[model samples]
Target: MPGRDETDILHSWHRNADAWTRAVREELIESRRLITDQAIVDAVLDNRPRSVLDVGCGEGWLVRALAAHGIQAIGVDAVPALIEHAREGGGSFQVAAYDDLIAGRFSQRVEAVVCNFSLLGEASVERLLAALPSLLEADGRLIVQTVHPLIACGEHAYVDGWRMEAWTGFGAAFPAPAPWYFRTLASWIGLFATSGWQLCELREPLHPQTGRPASVIFVARR
Candidate 1:
């Protein structure tokens, strides 16, 4: 069963779906424009995957982007509103949560599974990692981009724990802020190993203006 934080995180996304879709679509925020978006896209393209599964694909921007490149991509998110928005953009999308995926709700195995800044809690992540083996083709890869533990820590200490998003730039439009677990760089590597994933590559995306690391992208294989 999902814990309190996990449950809240899920609910918060549903509540914030409309606001988030607008923010991401109209603004194309600085971090996304400069770093995360292209980084994830480049990582996927580098693998030349024919089919891709985009987990927690909020608003399906990546799915549409991949489609524009002639790559077939299916996006899944927990919020129906987000999925609806994605469909409106002509992208294939499904309303499914991480638990749904683990329960084998989605049976198609793709060449790549992309989690774009979506893996949140340790328990949920562990379950998702364990389920990946059955969800990917033999030689498929998992591409994950997430908030860098260092940057996410902000003034907080460098440790494995839970952190809440300030949702600062998002303003009052977003009512429920989501909290996510923080795992150190070493912790991330260890989690992959214990979960039966081989960490193939790690990249740190930097803020174009400040030249400071913004997020970390991990490419792994089962």
Candidate 2:
């Protein structure tokens, strides 16, 4: 079992798949920033990957999108409801912890593994990054987009008092006592290096409307 904090946060966020989907859908619809993700996907999938596994694939949007383009896609999520939601959309769905996902029943010859805004959720960054290579093909790519540590850290505004924000558990509400690990750009690059991945591209996002920089984008190769 993961723990109270991980379980609580997962439960809260995934308790209602529709709500999560709607929130993300609305964010994308209003911002018109899918172009960046699209470009990253296109660049990584230049050779038309035969198998692509979307780690932490929430709600199946990316999996469905990739399948539509004749690529075999599988989405794995930690939350059961999210996995069911992904399965209902007609793609392979696995409800397993990130560490357990690799040994599951799936083709091991994955050409690319996509992690969109997922890996930084209070997990072991080094161990997780290290395991990604075995899940990919020889020339596979690891396309990752995460909340930049600086901006994400900024989200922890000390309201009421100088309190530290933490993940009390999965599906749990915020403001609970938990520890959060925020990484700098240099630290993230170094993490990949230690994890045996070579940096191929770094695509930091600019504020969609204002063109101000926001999050960091990373594309690594095994």
Candidate 3:
């Protein structure tokens, strides 16, 4: 089976823009605001990072939130339509693939890189992680959140497909035909450590309603 391309996912998202946006706002963004925003907000609170780069900023929801907190934020997306939708919300949005990000996009290194539920679909985690240092300031931070590797690989009857679950004895199998890389908590920290990042914090949010773990959140300083 072929790995899913980020572009293909973007195309699909664009095709269902209305429904996608609503789902994002309801299930992912608005509903999980406390879990998502609070974790990121706390990590950046002490540093007061100014300039921000939002990788895979779909629809600019998080970008706008960052701007509201007084951070100068610019969001980049692979989909032009999503970027356009994001731009309409009062922040700068650029149409660029994660693999294509270079120094030219920003005048200087940004103080923080916020990648919320993005980047997992990328074909190369090493290449994706490697790009962080160049995009980050010396004391900058990288805040990332995604479906927990363990849960992401497992079969979830609720979703009508496999979710994060155990496979190969230890690691996780990719949930779909996409390049969904799932790592255990240790593996996750290890990957960041190899790239010269010091782990700052790890938060696993409990669902507001069920109190079950929902997502894995990490804060790393470079």
Q: How many residue pairs clash in each candidate?
A: 0, 21, 9
lDDT of 2: 0.66
CA lDDT of every candidate: 0.88, 0.66, 0.67
lDDT of 3 at 216: 83
Ranking by lDDT: 1, 3, 2
> In model 1, where do residues sit more than 4 Å from their true spots?
1-4
Residue 39 lDDT in candidate 2: 50
- Compared with the true structure, model 2 gives a TM-score of 0.75
Candidate 3 residue runs with Cα over 4 Å from true position: 1-8, 26-34, 102-107, 156-179
| C-alpha-based local distance difference test score of model 3 | 0.67
CA deviation > 4 Å runs, candidate 2: 1-11, 16-18, 25-40, 102-107, 155-180
* lDDT of each residue in 95-117, candidate 1, tens digit only: 99989999999999999999998
Q: What are the TM-scores, per candidate, against the unseen true structure? A: 0.95, 0.75, 0.77
Best by TM-score: 1
Candidate 1: minimum summed lDDT over ten consecutive residues — where?
Answer: 1-10
Q: Report the C-alpha lDDT of model 2 over 1-222, residue by residue, as the tens digit.
A: 123244444555455455555544445433224444565456446657888888888777788878888889888877787777677767887876666754544446699888876664445546678878888888988988775666555655422112234432223233334333456677788888988999998876666576655567788898
